[model samples]
Target: MILDALFFLIQAGLTLFFWAILIAAILSLLTGFGILDTRNRFVWALSDFFYRVTEPAMRPVRNRLPNFGNVDLSPLVVMLLVQACMLLVGAIRGYMIRGGLYF
Candidate 1:
């Protein structure tokens, strides 16, 4: 019972975090090309928020990846990593829920 509840919480938390990272990625793409002007206060604030939220996850990846001049691929890498982590957690929970090794 407790394990079930814990699994649910983990699933939900990972899902929400995945979405947050996705949104930040989209906002970054748009802002990078100036499709969304940051001159306005609201836009600036929103962009800043996304930056603050995603920068930590992205910076390390960015540093490790080979630079492509103007292109940024850290967001894509981070998104893939987040998805992999979510899948790994879900699979582990599923295995435990089904009594894997005990069987």
Candidate 2:
């Protein structure tokens, strides 16, 4: 029971982080293209929130990846990595269920 609950929580967190990274990427693009004005308090706040939430996860990926000029691929890499982790957790949970190992 405890293991199942732990897995659920992990999956939920990964999913939330995945969406956050996606949103942050979109917001960044909009701001870069001038479609969204950072001068607007709401826009700025939202952007800042996403940046704070996503930056820690993205920083390592960013550091390892070679820069592509203005294009940032760290979010894409982070999303993929997070999805991979979610898959791994799900697989482990499924295995535990099938093997009756969740005691």
Candidate 3:
């Protein structure tokens, strides 16, 4: 019972994390390449919000990574981490089920 609830919470968090990383990466690519202009107020606001929200996770990675020409790899790293977390949660759930620890 408790394990099922915990698994649900973890799954939800990981799903959101994956989506946030994906959106941030797409936004970063569009903005970086000028495909997405922040000229419009709505675009600017959305970009700003995403930047603020994702930067804390990305900045450290950005600092540590070497630039690959015009490409930014921090968001890729973030996405990978999110996927890894989801996989980890899945593995935990599997283990619990196999052991009959989750009801």
Candidate 4:
């Protein structure tokens, strides 16, 4: 029961983080294309929030990657890594549910 709850919690956290990254990526593209102007107060606030939420996870990835002038691939890399983590968590939960270690 507790293991199931833990898995649920892990899944919830991953889902939230996944949405955050997706939003940040879309925001970056919109702002890049001038569709979302940051000068508006509300837009600015939301943009700042997204940056703060994503930067902690993204900055390290960005630092390790080569600087690509006028382009950033860190978000894509982060998304892929997050997906990998989700798979890992699901695999662990599956293993636990499948009778655990028997022997």
Give the number of the best model, judged by TM-score.
2
Question: In terms of TM-score, how similar is model 2 to the real structure?
Answer: 0.93
lDDT of 4 by residue, 55-82 (tens): 9999999999999996989888998888
Which ten-residue region of model 3 has the weakest summed lDDT? 13-22
**Model 1 lDDT per residue over 1-103, tens place:** 6667777788787677777778887887888888999898998898898788778888999999998998888878887888898899888876875875322
Q: lDDT of all predictions, in order shown?
A: 0.82, 0.94, 0.84, 0.87
Worst 10 residues of 1 by lDDT: 94-103
Q: Give stretches of model 1 more than 4 Å off.
A: 100-103
| TM-scores of all predicted structures | 0.84, 0.93, 0.83, 0.90
Please list the residue runs of candidate 4 whose C-alpha ends up more than 4 Å from where it truly belongs after superposition.
101-103
User: Using TM-score as the measure, what is the rank order of every candidate, best first?
Assistant: 2, 4, 1, 3
| True-vs-predicted CA distance for residue 20, candidate 2, Å | 0.2
* Model 3 lDDT at residue 87: 91
lDDT of candidate 2 over 49-87, digit per residue (tens):
999999999999999999799999999899999999999
* Candidate 1 clash figure, as a count: 0
Q: Tens digit of lDDT per residue, candidate 3, span 1-103?
A: 7877888998997787678777877877888888888898988888888788888888999999997987888888888887888898899889988998878
